[model samples]
Target: MSGDLDLELDPHAVGERVQARLDEVERAGGPAARAAADDAVRELMLLHQVALTRLLHGLTALPGTAAALPGLAADELVGGLLALYDLHPVPLADRVAAALPRVAGKLGREVALLGVDADGVAHVALTASGCGGGCGGSGAAAAEALTRAVQQAAPEVVEVRVQERAAPAPLLQIGRRDAGVPA
Candidate 1:
């Protein structure tokens, strides 16, 4: 190509496009062709992995890497690649915890990271500003945002389970105080 294409790629959109292409490849190709394509992809990934590891080692060996790695890991494109290569600077738990505040701010509710369980589920608890029993606290938008934020931050989590913590009981009770001589 004579000139580079001027375009911006959204990570989520790119992922969906990649997945669609993969699906198309699987559907259109016969078994042998599919095998060949799969092998090619595997080898390409392995090659990239090796190169990335080398690149990371080189980058870290530079004079002030510790100060720089987190900023690099926080970039969407770079972060995705680093995460894919298992080279993300932040621990999984920290990443997941970091995603919570943004979600809470938007949802206008209390959100917490309960923990990520052994099964790769991110347990998040959010106290929604919802009505009584039938209400789905914060509704779908908040749930989706929470899931996206956590997943983007910690890709290893296969699922985000949002537990609605029970709101505390009302402070002023109508019932009379329990039997006391001074009542």
Candidate 2:
């Protein structure tokens, strides 16, 4: 089991390596060879995508197997595969939304996914729920945690931007003391 067979089974690490090689090909190869390589890689990916889609459909059509998809979608490896092929039952927004609660718990503030931009950057809004959202710790840490969570949950997200939600206007309490009834 020498050679590449000895490589670890980390899908993301392998995928990154493959992407780096593709980038290198794009950079170094001639136009025609680069185009051909790109097409070949795309076609191979599409083939796997179609095959997996069919397999998932068939499995879900089975009586007992239908209930297993959500769990599969939540699993790290299977979820990553499903996400890579855009076959996950959960939407990207929902996945990002789900990660916000955990971020909120960690930051001890009310956090939410304001929206995801077209460039795959997730904009998160941090509201002043507890401690006025002004904790002494670094906001960068919160941003980093959020970025990591969203990316880990949905790799389609390319980046994360954390923003402070504007504090609500103060409520002014104005009550006439019963026309001089009491002081």
lDDT of each: 0.81, 0.81
TM-score of 1: 0.80
Give me the displacement of residue 134 in model 2, in angstroms: 7.1
- Per residue, candidate 1 scores C-alpha lDDT tens digits across 1-183 of 537753455777887887777777878886677777778878998899899999889988999996799998887777877877788888878999999998888777789999988888999988866556454444566778899999888777889988877766668857767677566
Q: Which ten residues in a row have the lowest lDDT in candidate 1?
A: 130-139
Q: Please list the residue runs of candidate 2 whose C-alpha ends up more than 4 Å from where it truly belongs after superposition.
A: 1-8, 26-28, 117-119, 128-136, 166-183
Clashing pairs in 2: none
lDDT of 1: 0.81
lDDT of 2 by residue, 1-183 (tens): 567674337777888998888778878876776788889989999999999999998998899987788787887677778989999888889989987888788777778788988888888987654455457235777778888888888888888988966556688999767875866
